[model samples]
Target: MSLIMRPATEADIDRLVDVYFSAFKENPINIRVFPESSPQSRAFWKKNLEGDLKEDYVRFQVMETVDEPKTIAAFAVWNAPQKATNPMPPMPPLSAWPSDGEVDVAAEFFYDIERQHKRFMGPLEGAPEGSQQRPHWYLELIATHRDFQGRGAAGALLRYGEQQADAAGVPCYLDATPDGRPVYTSKGHGFREVESRLYQGGAYEHVFMIRDPRTSA
Candidate 1:
């Protein structure tokens, strides 16, 4: 099916919420990590992203088949040059910590902190060796419906985001959950060990990740 890609609008909020939940339904780390976050982690993310648009820090996008305007198969949330204005827990420590056993503990608390660090000091979040500048844009969220995982839908979304970032002559940044890390890597996103954390719901473990297209080929 051909997808009509466009910037999300207010009318699209509900569907975007559904798409946001559906795409991130299984990713708990993405759900947590926000300071002063709520029990309804999913709800928090939905409201936070949509609500934060006021700060001009958010840019929403959707991929929909021509047949269903109410149904969104994929979505991307981008953050302009601004701080992550949401309630979130403190960032966990890196390497110095141990694992929580074979159950795949959430080893990404430090990841969240790293993201916060980026919020505080863009391009200096984890400050690469001799790194002096921060990327121009950031990706708050990105996902595709499970049914369309392997499709080029995600790349299409990223391309849209890239165009936005490229227009500003800056690189794009983001935090990838566990599953997203590899995907981002394949797309040339570098994976750094930030903080690891245990999400309350399923106790899902997640790692913090960053992506910069500038340094990538």
Candidate 2:
């Protein structure tokens, strides 16, 4: 199926939210963190998604069939590196979670993500060894509608960010779920596993991977 990529807009929020929830409906971490899907929970996602769209450093893109009545097949959220002088705002606070959501688990998960992000993506200048201190792109989120899996939609979305990072002579970063690790680390992709962590007492796990810029022939 032919697909086209485009920047997501505020008008797409309703469909985007539905696609996001549908794509991760069975994800272990999401299942644990957001066991129930309420209007409040959806509201939180909508608000944060809007905030992401407005951020200069954030790139939110959606993929759709090229045919008429284009149907959104997948979406990805990327965070472009910013200068230290103007740091991006932190992730939404725990209080921002819905009343029925697993606040503690969600908080812990986000905390770990932030810690690893800051540690691995350090200053872009005069940095230390073994640190990717460069202006890189971070894959904050990527998902495809269940019915759309295996159609290359997700890979296309990922490659869009990879292309941007390559043009800037920087790397790309992402935390992959077990099911996604193989694809991300596969040859041609070149994402190396840098760290792995388990949450909910091993019920859920994510592997952090980094891909250096690829030079054109």
Candidate 3:
């Protein structure tokens, strides 16, 4: 099987969103946040992906199998340091959402998650201090399509980001789910857990990890 990794473009948004939705549809955090499998959930995710693709500070990449290049096997989204006058823009307005009611419900769920995160992390300390003080690469999302889980596509995408981070002389940061912790801690990435927090009323816990830039020997 031939596999390729490349930067994602606007034309790839739908496939990228599909990969993300399929990978996270059953995730504990996504289930807790979205709750329902509806057009609204799909639309929200699609729009979010679109917005990410349009942002100058964001980078989106996808992995595809050569036999079916149009089908995304995995994807990763990241945020680079932004210029002082060009901070990351806000999410699309409510009117752009698919359904007002669904958006409201999702907003409340996200708020709860944020509140829990803040409570566990403490004010202004959710991320590592070094990352806050310096320009760093932030991994916003990474997922492998369910059918492609065992094939190492996720690791490939992660290493791509690490190479970029190393080239920039900056650390890389990501929030990991329970199932993803092992992968992030494995040899190549050198990620260390900086914080952990339980959510969903104690049903789950998320891990925050960072990989410091490699120093020349």
TM-score of each: 0.62, 0.92, 0.79
| Model 3 per-residue lDDT tens digits across residues 75-172 | 99977755323323344565655563455644544454444433332324454443323456778789888888889888888988898889889778
Error of 2 at 177 (Å): 0.8
Better of 1 and 3 by TM-score: 3
TM-score, cand. 1? 0.62
lDDT for 120 (candidate 2): 75
lDDT for each residue of candidate 2 in 13-66, tens digit (9 for 90 to 100):
888888888898988667666653687778988898898899888999999889
Choose the strongest candidate by lDDT: 2
In the predicted model 2, the residue pairs found to clash are none
Alpha-carbon local distance difference test for all models: 0.57, 0.83, 0.72
Best-first order by lDDT: 2, 3, 1
Q: Which one wins by TM-score: 1 or 2?
A: 2
Q: Spell out the clash pairs found in candidate 3.
A: none
Model 2 alpha-carbon drift over 4 Å, by segment: 124-133
**What is the TM-score ranking, best to worst?**
2, 3, 1
Better of 2 and 3 by TM-score: 2
